[model samples]
Target: MTAPTARIAGEESARDQGLARGVGLWSFTFSILNGVVGAGIVALPASMAAAAGGYAPFAYLAVALVMAAVVVCFAEGGSRVPTSGGAYGTVEAAFGKGAGFLAGIYMWLASVLACGGIAAALCDALGALVPALAGVGPRLAILLLILGGISWINVRSAGLAAGVIAWGTVIKLVPLGLFVAVGGLALLVGHDPAPAAVAPQGGHFSEAMLLALFAFCGMETPLGASGEVADPTRTVPRATILAMLCVLVLYVAIQVVAQGLLGAALAGSAEPLADGMRQISPALGLVLLAGGILSRFVWIGSDVLGAPRVLFAFARDGMLPAWLGAAHPRFATPHIAIWVHSAIAFALAATGTFTRLAILSTLATAGLYFLACAAALVLRRRGVAILGTPLSFRILPLAAGMGMASMVVLVAIARIDEILAFVGLTFASLALYAVMRPRIARAA
Candidate 1:
């Protein structure tokens, strides 16, 4: 009996170890969804209005289409490798270790910068709801506190971190869905805003469209967690596509409702959706605003889960410290990597400029996506099998590449400073890589 019990425990331990390498399919889907629909949605209407005028809905649709293309490209690449590092791993495999190191650094910096943006946004929302902490000093302190709390959750355990993200995502989605449904109902009841209220003005289509694209950033977060997913090939693709579709529907519907409810006002308002909902029901507006704050928490949680996995993957490949590649003995999670990510995220959140951070983060991610699509083309041309699957570079990869390239161009036109920031950050990454290469190789 004792021998049989020991055998059972050993088998269970092995199973746990294997499972720790990836998460279940539903968990993967939820993680992706959580990553895609963050605090940006709260700011979407304002960004769209700034670019597209009243035609924010159309801009959203266009953004969704572009995002879909990117999603398809990610699906192809992610399905092939399904590793923790995502774009870094794919690019490394397609190119070489040097390129992989650069890609991983870019992605890591992006994730950390994103964490700062999310933390700032969360603090802003909290300050708005609590007037006592509305001052800059208090808000910054609150932001630090929030970052600390989130970091603690992340380092505690993978399941706990993922569970937090999963639940937070669901909670945030409910209000967004409600806003869409209620807004659609209002439109059906002949409460639609005037066409002038929803149409783009002065032919600023390109600018508005680019801003919309920005709103759809983070759609490929699931790929970052591919290493932790149960079935990377099937689950990563399905989860990526599904998360994007969900975000698209919610974004478009929300835009339509917001435009109808506030018209040109939606374009100018910082909290457009909340303001629009206020027009419908002040109580609901408050509720949605509260939800937006919670959504930021969800975003942070998802980032904490996803970013460390990328580091872990890079570490495994000798691009970083091998110790970072160590999985938890009991939990089978990347505990060390998680702590390192949280520490960096906390430092950035505590001190970084939000605008600069946001721009750098977005640009870095966009650049990586562009490279992933290009790599897909390269792999297809070389007749390489991606994860035992046949490689094919169809129109989707080209479209995705072009779309991302256009976005990069548009961002350059609209915000050159941000582009420069991305460039500067890339240079910093390269410097770190140069300094660490020897040590990484020696450790490997």
Candidate 2:
């Protein structure tokens, strides 16, 4: 007999209470884009320049190609499962409940830590505008306020949250677009691109590819929102691919423009994109700064929106407390889970432990991506066709293999402290899993 299928418990409640299947293709695409391109994009070109020197833009493209394969694997898994837990659901469907639990917890923890970083960045942005907000008390207050605002937006409805995300996407790109247009004009008028003296090498190129991978970290947002989409199997794959393509173009453009203008100083500048724009015009840099702040809002909001759904998925599947899976009677949203996520993120951001946790967060993200790809490969080998159709390239196994290799490289490149931390978390989670094994087995 085939393996048992694990499912969440609240499908009818979701429909009756308030969740609707109305997200269109455009909305879903922009939502994923919002998740993938955040304030991180503003800072990436600099770090990439540090790692890969003058060929930094090429690093972005190489990693994008690798990540695109990973996306295809996730797309296949999502098309099969198309549930809230996303990678969690897909892995469990192919592997078992045990594997699913690990994936879910890993993703949830990573998202919480990432939210802390975003909150801190937002506070810094606020502090830049209002110097008095730099105090610990005021910073914490503002962080809590922003976190609360995001929770409120997500708790009400997914549609409203998606709309906010879509609008934010449009607004955040305006400054970047302006910079690119002007920078291109300058280049056409005999301005030299890449005035930097550093040259690229193989070792640095690999390191840069690894660094750029994190920039694409949130590409799984569409998978997380699958349950709310109107034709998830079709919409998910299309949206994921399109979002990746758009982001790839944006990342390369930003890197090229920033590197050309900043030259030798690109790697040292904290605000590379803004600095490059400043060279063109100081006023343009200010606009890019504003856009950078706005971009943080978009991604942080997307994180708050997506992270809770992972817990909701687990709770519904009987992997965690059922209360977490409960949809609000009136709102039809997972309000409890959302609040819990917001609370944890707020606490981490307030205490500043989130920075330490960020390394583990990257490891966990890589783990989840690897597991999802493996699941897709396993399902394919087992003759399962849950993803509906093969990818246009008809290379599911190849894509999965490439994704797995990338994850290995990422893990290998992780710092010693991050590896130790990841190992410790893995063992602790294993112990917890042993205790929950009976429950998981029964649910399955």
Candidate 3:
């Protein structure tokens, strides 16, 4: 028993050593930025304006405050687990395989759906640019090219993927920065900043928050690649906190500029940011439209870099076939995993509308966050050791509880159909876990 156990442990260590730790603090921070600031910033301004009139920015603020606590919980979990499965690893460590598997599905689905939703949005922007290509044929072709190309890059190298994301972040932010600077200046000069509509009434505020939450939801998916991160305990929390801060500030600024510039017309504009930019210059408005398209392309690249690792991790840990976990000897990356998920994402992007996919992804991520917060308390109580230097701030229970409560509230207020789909997925995960339990134990 001792000899066999030693041999088994050795094999597991060999498997664990497969992935590269190419993602450092800055790279990981950029990953967080790349992950969070995708199509949400590009396309949601009008939706937000419609939901809350001029008060839309406050809804973003409201959600951010609650999500901040959730981020702390995740930061703590990331430090402790610091593995590829990310939230899956943290949750599994606290509970059992069954619970971990369920959380993993949520993490994986959230990434795929978000990527698909953004992909659809990208095509929509393209359609706007070239009305001739607005038909389904062109949209499908575009998604194929972007998804196929980006997934190839990911299969080749994690470092290469990170580089793409890091640079992509700067490129996408340019138009947004210009809009805020130029639009904000114009507003100050002689702008009528009053909103034509009143504060969010009826269920409008609730709806506003749902959109705001989507803007914030994609940030956490990158944490699924914690194993690729160098010195995760040092890197994860710092990078996550900094990126989340940037997201909050940037989102608020964009909302303010768009609102003040467009005023009463903000809600009615299909292209709020573009319209606001056009008020100053038509050429600038075109830039914003092009920026939206570029943002989605970059976002899909980031999704490939970070999300497929969840599949690789699952395969590595024996939750699924070992082939899914197998790193390509030539590239030292999870090529099979990347390809498999890319295919699924493409299909979803082809079939689903942006709004439907965004709502589904948001609800999935919120549920995942709620579970992770609960896992944080369990991990602390179980004395899960930090993978590197300990955090300076204490992991307060109040914060964990608040995060959990916030997620519950988020899910509770979403459309009933979305809630039902979430529940259905949860049950499906449990059923699959039970069936796979024997294989899981054998792998363990």
Best by TM-score: 3
Per-residue CA lDDT of model 3 for 1-444, tens digit only, reads 234323423442353478888888988897787678886677788778777876898899999998888888888877866776667767776676788788888988988988898888887788878888789999889989999999998888789888877787788889888988999899889876534444433237777887788899766667767878887788988999999999999999999888788777777665678878877889999999888787888888877887788888777767877889989999999999999989999998999977678878888888888889888887666656545444534745887889898888888988898899999998987887777678888877
C-alpha lDDT of candidate 2 relative to the true structure: 0.75
lDDT of 1 by residue, 372-416 (tens): 877666555555443345324367656666766765675575566
The true-versus-predicted C-alpha distance at residue 298 of model 2, in Å, is 2.7
**How would you encode candidate 2's per-residue C-alpha lDDT over 162-242 as one tens digit per residue?**
789778878877777887888778766866544546543324675676567767787665566576777777887888889
For model 1, name the residue pairs that clash.
22-228, 23-228, 51-208, 54-198, 55-198
Of candidate 2, the 10-residue stretch with the lowest lDDT total is 4-13
lDDT of model 3 at position 316: 76
TM-score of 2: 0.82
Error of 2 at 191 (Å): 4.7
- Ordered from best to worst lDDT, the candidate numbers read 3, 2, 1
| Position 266, candidate 1: lDDT | 68
TM-score of 1: 0.81
How many Å off is the CA of 111 in candidate 3? 0.9
